[model samples]
Target: MFVLPDDDDRQFAVTLARGLEMLRCFLPGERMLANRDFVERTGLSKATVSRLAYTLTELGYLRHDVEARKYRLGGGVLSMGYPLLAGMRIRQIARPFMRELALQIRGAVSLGMRDGMNMVYIESCSADKRSDTRPDVGAVHPVLRLAMGRAWLAGVGPEEREVALNQLRVGVPDQWQRYRPQLDQAMRDFAELGACFSHGDMQKNIYGIAVPLSAPVDSETLVFNCAVMDHTPQARALLDDVAPRLIAMIANVESAAGLRQTVTTTPPRYPRR
Candidate 1:
């Protein structure tokens, strides 16, 4: 294998991301792991795993059982993540509905919420006929790439949406600018249309349509979206059909959550492009 002499500098970040991926390898089930056992499952070199394990332990994100030489997620992980998870309990309520939508549309469905300047996918369900593009459950996608981001942006207050936009601009690579104007226009259009759709933003040949979940009483600022890369001759028609259904779904979710069950069926505040 040809290795660059300066690869060590680049290696540190890759190692950190790898270690995080290792943590995810252990899902909600199979909660514990032994050193020897972990190495085999993660496919990471034993030495690297050892060092990474020690680092995680120190950070309180992972803990080891001294006697069994086994490891488990540290309480620290929960400690750091509890409140966010608590707030996103909407996932528990929205999952079934999202599943229903996916079944109805024969597309991938997702329920999302805003976190800082990004749209976080709390739940996603892929239809049987459409497979291969697997989006990790907790993964976050840039707002400019998909309808989820734009839809949520439309619903949030200006302060929040602007801050999120600034953050996104900084986080994304500079090379992605060819689509910058288009994204800005989408955001503006979403504000007017009360929803958003996209083609080839995050991935080539992929398409998405999204709408802000109607906050029950308060009008939630987050979005609900559906994406498909499977196969479609008329992506636009499918997206349009999905929008009204998405609005009603959000209304159901907000009412169930008791956070905002009185949102007005107000028309989109922005002008059509």
Candidate 2:
């Protein structure tokens, strides 16, 4: 039995929630899934999963593959994202600045927001003429492992950070162990420098530095990161020089957005057990 929220004013929509969950079952790099896959992922009955799959396919949210007997995300997902993407003022305001920063660092810069355990890229700029480092707008990186995520977590309230950490502890215990120490240090770095660095933490050869931004309008914690493919002397210089610039850029953004209040003090750090 599905448990509804305890709030009396909240109206629950079971079908809608299940449909969204079915959609979320498709992870990064998973191009296709069967009804059985949805059933396994969601713990829904096979019959219910089949019905939902058919309904979603008819609604243009899922594309059915007749030959492969699978379903992939359809164009309707783009429609769902377009309005949200279009309305993000930060992305619009940060574009030119990100472009300039990318060019200055001769690498890639991105603005990201936390989505569950992942940091979703909302906007990106690449200095490479070929745009080799540019990630897709909706690309996601693990929150505990990426520089942007660390910066974001560093800025969020203590309760929210604890909730997220608890979720990590329950969901991905091994990863939580691997990342706990680094995250603690990143929290300290963010407290001292207002920025966090990831030296080949996410990708083997890639290095990145990130700073959090205060988004008062929506109360969303956002982050900006500069990523380079390799840890060279140039990368080290960029990390040293660009991190301060990144913090200043975020301050400029907050000022432009009329978010006068800043999160100067770091949230209480989570202890490594």
Candidate 3:
């Protein structure tokens, strides 16, 4: 059940609401949007949007695209996120392995987790084709239409994955009910493969695979995944070589963390490579 909010909780909640609103203002697809698009997309007053945009751009969360007269993610944002992902060793342990996986597999390799209903990319190593539209760390992608999200969904138990699916309703913009059949198919497929994959789902011409992390974790512990693109039967082989390395990297991360069951009520965090 959702907790009833006290004053402190209420105030904190408000902060989160605004922060989220601000985040939605930045989309990787657009990366940079002009003021008009920003106001239209956000449905905020022009003045409010302008002020927030300016403040964020100045604060280094967003950058102004002078030529396009739009805004995009700034280096400052990466500066802040790098340490967090690095601290977790998820990227550290996974990077060398991912690059090796990408080299061996010759496709994109990514490590990701569910965060507040979206999949937050923690690490990525990719080939030229995958890099053409590569997802960056700190990029929050819809759990739907992505193999990385399915890996998380598939790795967990049925009851637990369902809870995550339910939570996805609130976290994702659209309702999950609409895609129940597809999700069910994915769940069944994951049960068989021990991993999940998708083609042209998150983006056209993109494909991937993923697995789980978090040993000694609870039923509710989030699923983690590694994904590789499928460009050819040759590239499809990347998943085979990459999967074992990803499994090993996850094991290394778990061993580093000592397999303790410390539930972080807050979301899991990862630092950069």
Candidate 4:
């Protein structure tokens, strides 16, 4: 279910929010969904789901499957993201460095920004053979599950970090036990090294290391990550060596983008447990 402000909240548009919530029901690898799926996911009445689906289809935000009776996201969704992606100065400034890092590690490098409870990839550069789980622009992953997200959480202030972590715990209670220990360790690692690494935690055979980057031009916190598909010794060595390089690359990008003076120190003030 999606969260919505109370009716008393100012400037809240219920219909528009519900429409967007319906769109979010289509997750990664989910190509199509029927009206019933929306009803079930959103806990809305069948009539309401049908109406929302029809409205979205008419607006071109969703494409109706005439033969299969399903709906898929349409070009309209891309329209919403294009402006943001095109306007991101950090993506432009970091692209060349991301490409170089990918080529140097012969893997994938991505820049992502936090989106609600997930991290959304805004820019990605990949070597010839990319990891199976290597996400492209617009791909979303759980915030606490990926190295990029963990690094970002590490950079946030304590209160914000606690809020995000609490959201994760409440949203995915089943996985909290397994995630807590690793998250604690990542906090320590980031405190010491300014970066953190993950080995097949989010996806088996996918290894990654990430560092956070905060640019002066944008309020959003972004992270840079280098990833490899294999979990072999070679991949581990590459991850270990590339992490520091990734940090340096971010430093260079921040310097070029005039963000060095704005970057915050590590182990950002956290509330005592």
lDDT of each: 0.67, 0.80, 0.62, 0.81
Report the candidate with higher TM-score, 3 versus 4: 4
Most lDDT-accurate candidate: 4
Residue-wise lDDT of candidate 1 within 1-273, one digit each (tens)? 111234467545667665775675564457688766657766777898899899999999898889877889988876776676566667788888778777766677886666543567767877764454336566676666667877777767779767776766665546237567767777766756666878777777667778876552224466778776635656555665666666666766777778575643432233323
Q: Which is the winner by lDDT between candidate 3 and candidate 4? A: 4
The global Cα lDDT (0 to 1) of model 2 is 0.80
In angstroms, give how far residue 183 of model 4 lies from its true place.
1.2
lDDT-better candidate, 1 vs 3: 1
Q: How far is candidate 3 from the true structure (C-alpha RMSD, Å)?
A: 8.1
Score candidate 3 by lDDT.
Answer: 0.62
How far out, in Å, is residue 129 in model 4? 4.7
Tell me how far candidate 1 lies from the true structure as C-alpha RMSD in angstroms: 9.0
Each prediction's TM-score against the native?
0.62, 0.86, 0.67, 0.88
Q: Model 4 — which ten-residue stretch has the worst lDDT? A: 264-273
lDDT of 1: 0.67
- Please, what are the lDDT tens digits per residue for candidate 3 over residues 140-239? 8777766677777777667876787767776454646655565667777666645566666667766566666644243234344544445555656554
**Residue 254, candidate 2: how far off, in angstroms?**
2.2
Top-TM-score structure, candidate number: 4
* Residue-level lDDT tens digits of model 2 in 82-168: 998898887888788788878877888898998877899999999885755677889988988898998888988899999888877
User: Which order, best to worst by TM-score?
Assistant: 4, 2, 3, 1
Candidate 1 vs 2: which has more TM-score: 2
* Model 1, runs deviating above 4 Å: 1-56, 62-83, 115-118, 173-176, 216-221, 233-236, 259-273
